[model samples]
Target: MRTQVAIIGAGPAGLLLGQLLHAAGIDNVILEQRSGDYVLSRIRAGVLESGTVRLLDAVGAGARLHAEGLPHDGFDLLFDGARHRIDLAGLSGKHVTVYGQTEVTRDLMELRAGQGALTVYEAEKVALHDFDGDAPYVTYLDRGEQKRLDCDFIAGCDGYHGVSRASVPSRALKTFERVYPFGWLGLLADVPPVSHELIYAGEERGFALCSMRSNSRSRYYLQCALNERVDDWSDERFWAELRRRLDPATAEALVTGPSLEKSLAPLRSFVAEPMRFGRLFLAGDAAHIVPPTGAKGLNLAASDVHYLSEALREHYAERSSAGIDAYSTRALARVWKAERFSWWLTGLMHHFPDHDGFGGRIQQAERAYLISSPAAMTALAENYVGLPF
Candidate 1:
């Protein structure tokens, strides 16, 4: 098979990149190791930054999102049992939309199906071949048969564990990573959200987040030991922790439903230098990953595709590789900025047991300063809400 771009992985990054390139009359193929059902049903990031929303809207992918997603003007920062609302709208004139990653994947999958784009799922041994050479290929096993796909370029939109990053030479790539001492045990419930806005709680026990997926369903998370097991947490135990973190003032009827899903995500900060190497380019989690505290994962993936798509479009239009050549440096600038923000947010909200009283005091002072100073607040709001691509 041949295409202008052979994209590895059918995640949001690859799907959106294909869509953007398709609109610009570029040919691309997406390969995935999982079935379409698994890809669409995977529980992932829910929050979408303003820039992401606009990009989806521009591509006609926001119709369902606009109708079904909840828009919040701001979020609440809870500390010492006090709630401080950061007016996202008032601060940046932009708001975030609460729609699950599954929904976005479903929407894009439907769109791609209708268009008859080349998408192969449940493929195995998906490896990038000759990525350092001018003619790079993607070799995978489809239906027990090995297939080789030749393309002008290869995009590694696969997640952290995928083969894209591994294809790069260790000497050429500089890896930076910081793993947190804690992880988040996220839960999806059938109950309505306890609050109107997303609530981020910083307590002595740990950090907690109250977010919504829909009017009837709520998504919540609590910080726990990095090695904690989901089997250790019972339904009653989960609610107890949530109640303590959320601390509902009134006796609102709290109904506990069967947890549709639960998982532990270890917090970490990672970035690989030079997102591009020869004809192979990396995007999304393949290039960088941020702790989920700032809700930047999905948006960061979208931002990468937005920039890469534009670069590829320019390459096709002008028949110049300048845009493609500069892809890594351009994308890394934004990637690092987001990395700092995610790290800062995670450090401020999460209580590290190893940190002493002075460390806690420093975090508190930072949060206080963020809320008090307009410049600091604006910076937070700008990064949280998102910047224009």
Candidate 2:
């Protein structure tokens, strides 16, 4: 097989990149280790920055998103017993849409299919070859048969645990990571959310987030011990625990129901410096990871796709390597800022096992100052809406 770009992974990042490049008249093929259904089954963040939405629109895949996605101008920050609102639009001149990551992937997948794009699912044991020099290619196993694809460039969108980053020699890749002491026990149910917009609540017990997939389907999370097991928490117990951390009014207004899905996710801040390697490039989870506190995971992937797609477009259209040469530096600049924000938010909102009385007071003072000062609120709002791409 031959193509201009051989894309690894069929997740949102890879699919979106293919769509963007195909729209630019670039020939590309996507390969995935899992079935298409498995990709959509993986539940993920639902918040969308304006820039991400624009990218979907560029590829003619935003019709369903704009029609069904919820738009929010602000969210509430709850600390102590009170909830203070931050006007995201007023502060940053931008707002985010509440659309599930699954839906976004579905839209992109369906759009690609309609355009007759080739995506090989269940292409197992995929590996990159000759990415350090010109004439890069990919090899994979299909139904126990070995196959090879030759391409001008290889895109490693397979994710942090996938073969993409692991393909790079350890000496050539520098990694920085911080595994948080706690995890998020999340539950998705058919109940309406306690509030119209998201609520980030910090309590003496722990942190709890009130979010939703839509007006009718609520998604909630509670800060949990890293050693906690998902099987140990029942729906009733999860709802009760979430209610305890919320303010009285919110707790009273909260609706309870059986969970559609339950899972535990450990929080972490990770980055691999210099996202490009010769003809190979890493986008999305292959490059960096942020805690869910800031809702930057999927959005960061979108931004990476944006930068990479633009560079590839420039490379093909103008016969210039300027954008390609600068891709890593540009993507990393915004990435580190997001990493800082997610780390800060996670620290401020969660209870720590080692935090003494003085440390607790410091966190309280920080949250108080954030709500009391317009400058602090504006800063939070700007980061929440997203930094410029």
The TM-scores of all predictions, comma-separated, are: 0.97, 0.99
Model 1 per-residue lDDT tens digits across residues 1-389: 89999999999888988899999999999999999988877898789998888878776789999999999889988887777888888889899999989999888888888899989999899988887888889899999999999998999999999989998889999999999999999999898887878888888889999888998998889999987999999878998887777556711445567798899999899999989998899999999999999998889899899889988999999988888888888888889899999999899888898998899889989988877888887788888988777
RMSD of each: 1.3, 0.7
TM-score of 2: 0.99
- lDDT of residue 275 for candidate 1: 93
lDDT of 2 by residue, 160-202 (tens): 8989999998888899999999999999999988999999998
Residue pairs whose backbone atoms clash in candidate 1: none
- TM-score leader: 2
Clashes of each: 0, 0
lDDT of residue 83 for candidate 2:
92
